[model samples]
Target chain A: MPKLLEISKPFIVLVEGKDDAEMLYSLTHSMGMPKDEFQVLQYGGKQKFPSFLKQITNFPEFEMVTKLAIFRDADENSQSAFQSIEHHLKSSDLIPQDSVPTHSGEVKKSDSGFAVGIYITPDCSNKGALETLLLDSLTSEMKSEIETYVTQAEKSLSTDRARDKYKNSTKSRTYAYSALFENASFHDTFNKRLWDWSHPTFNQLKTFLQAF
Target chain B: MPLVQSVHFSNYRNFTDFTMDGLQRINLIVGDSNVGKTGLLEGLVTLWGNEEQFKALPNTFRMSYGDYTTSLDSFWSWLHPQRNHSLTMILRSTDIDNLMRAVRYEDHVRYDRDSVERSLQKTPYKINILPIGIGNYEFQVDLFNQLANTKNGKESLVSSLQVIEPRLKGLDYLKLPSSNHAMVYADVDLDYKIPTTQFGHGFTRSMEMLSNLILSGSDIMIADEIENGIHYSALGSVWKAIIDYAVKNDVQVFATTHSRECIAAAHEAMSEQENYELNVIRLQNRKGEVVAINHNKEDIETAFDLGLPLR
Candidate 1:
């Protein structure tokens, strides 16, 4: 759902990877935002944020861009992720180079309506990833059932080497939930609208999308 | 350190008030077609060259795809925005003291000063333009003749040729009685001295360009579509020769390319050098103005790793 090479829209939303981009594509659409209002692009990984930021600013369409949104996972530290985006944003040749917003769901607008913003997943302040947000969106009964299935699946493994992959992995838990629906892919779960897009857990992320 | 630290162009072929600073010794310009790649090279040659060069090479430096209008009196006439013919084109670089300004009147071009000309004459370097097909075979023979006059120039040519063809034993210029004209030949350790052109386009292309860099004794070498004739397998070797010769002689080289392999080869070649002095300058046409985006060594390496749309 997310475009890779060219940026046809005036407003760009940079995601961490392809799955994030594809998920945000339907998420933003479900949030009542106009389809042509923005474009979501993947930078492959968070370590390449500076390189991607430096390169996109050189595009001819960048001059016409009025807003930039960075969506990366919190992973370990949310503040650090936000700071990384802020550092590269200031270094870029974006119009009205200024400070980025420090808090999530807040937008800093330039005098020319050219603003740059950031939103770290999952829940903006948590030390987790997009899968954490997806897992929280499930109903209480469904969440417990999926967690038990993932725990027992880890016990069935032959060795701790194979079991280590499931330990502290919200990704494996999310995949287990998606596996219930005909073995859909990571993005297919997002594309097929299998997840509860209108869940209250997405309120902060929805608010962040409104800033662009 | 860069020789020409910065350059500002005022009304030079649709590039109105564009400044490209942070120039390195070796720069590769890339962009969409007709975005002033060749114009940047030509503008530099005119800004740093003398009146003799302008008279002798008015249209030779242009790319084959540029708008070649015969109605214009000379290349200088088109330097003006919309060809008004009344404005003076001013080119300023950090290395030179005076601004090189020129105006075209009724039939010819006029300059106010020749400081850049005198400065070039005093130095041991000049400007050489190598467009696609550099020159004819006879022209290559002439270059070989010039380079042979100096010490080790002949051996250098043979060894550099060995980069693409290891069997090459020697290079010579001969005008045999049976031949219609004089030309250059290669000794590929075969039975007879094979004509260089008889080898292949890649070999002849590499021979002409590698020799031109050494034989012309140019301080600045401008090439267009550097990967035109050479094959993909030999791109790395050709790039090594260009980088080595350019660094050894402190020559400022500007080459344009549309091939990713060419860009990678140039980047790879510079990586082996002691110091990294390569920059990829991409010109983008926004609205009506030409904008330049310079990617240094780190940026280029990132582009390669991420598959960025740098070209």
Candidate 2:
């Protein structure tokens, strides 16, 4: 019989919640690497970011995590969400793309060693559109809640001021989730799932470890 | 050259136990006459005699404490009229491994039949000669004891003549041609064989000092009252020669005296020369105790200008 391939690498997975941590754990277990070869940790939430940042910065393998993936729920308050999380990175001079000035020096002066991204369940077009999309879900109760939430988010996005605020809130949520995920991997496994839907690539997480 | 680095005594005189340190070729013992200055020198002479290799003198001479009384028991009556007398010494030498050894009294026998022993108020007199070098060859014969008020008590007072080796008997004596009379040897026994007693005290003292210098190999020479009979003109030359010998042989000197000329002589010897380190320990007798008043070259000059007695 042909032998099974083995992974002899130490990896860590960072996530925001125990649920996310368990989810990442399950994903990597099914992936090529054994669950034992990687570590996993959850930062709990954004409130712990500063302490987590300090704790992670001291790791000798801090720069080795190959990938630092972020996962956050994009609620309709973009600007508020950005405000809640942007201070730490701002002080570090990492101006987010949305906040950056067009001047070339601005980016050079403000870029920190981190990236930002957001995940949002796209908004329906009309008043009854969310309710119809909800019908496609297997759990009718969850579908209804999603429908209600999406409707509220869409209404909040209707005005430009509200829309910017919602976008910022969603962006902060994603940044917070990513920060949690990275901090978790710093404390535990590196090649584990980052969110319920996405796993941190071994190569990406390995970058944080500095050694493959 | 006759510097005494240190002196130790154990029953040699009134010093039941005494030591002298920071010695020089000239040492001043300037207290009341009875405070045991000459007695100390007598003890040193006895110690020198005990060492046969350096047999500067014969072991037959035992040191006796020179005080007013003829008997040891009556010494208290003559001096303090209250306290009994006993003395001990421990001399230190860099050349000797056992740096200190005691000089003690060795002959004591109890006789109840004797009339004096029966009437005695205190314990019978006992003299012990402490063993030096642990029973190795006449080590126990260094001390001579004089006990009082006993019929059998033998008065064994040996002369200080043993300070130097006994001359090959009769070698020091010469028969005069006229009547074949024999003349005693002098320190400077040149052609005329001038008896040391007939020679100038300075010459005789220098000769004696030179003989000691050759014998002791002492780094420190301490002469108490170095000006005893020294001539003023020869004083400077004598000091210079002594210092020269000390420097060449790695010796130091401590001398004490009440003579102003002697102080000037030492100053002249030291000031006009280099190489030999010099200091004077002026002694001040307060009440019944003697304490040193130390002075360096500058201090000595200042004190001299003030007409203060260095002794």
Best by DockQ: 1
lDDT of 1 by residue, A66-97 (tens): 88888888889988877777777767655466
lDDT (10s digit) by residue, model 2, range A1-212: 12311212234443455544554455445444566765554444555544343333223244443323332222444344334344443443212334322221121111443333221111211122111211332245644554456456567566787766554233233333334454553214224443322313222322322222
Candidate No. with top TM-score: 1
TM-score of predicted chain B versus true chain B for each candidate: 0.79, 0.47
Point out the worst 10-residue segment of candidate 2 chain A by lDDT: A122-131
Candidate 2 fnat reads: 0.00
DockQ each: 0.32, 0.00
Chain A TM-scores for all candidates read 0.91, 0.37
* TM-score on B-chain, cand. 1: 0.79
The residue-by-residue lDDT of candidate 1 on B1-311, one tens digit each, is: 64666778787678888888788888899998888887777777666665565554456565333233442455656666778656557766765333233322233454634544464454423777775655486677777898899888888878777766789899888776768977777777778787777876656767788788777667888887888778877778788777777787778888888888888888998999999999999988877889888998878877777677777
The interface root-mean-square deviation of each model, in the order shown, is 3.8, 44.5
Model 1 Cα interface RMS deviation (Å): 3.8
Candidate number achieving the greatest lDDT relative to the actual structure = 1
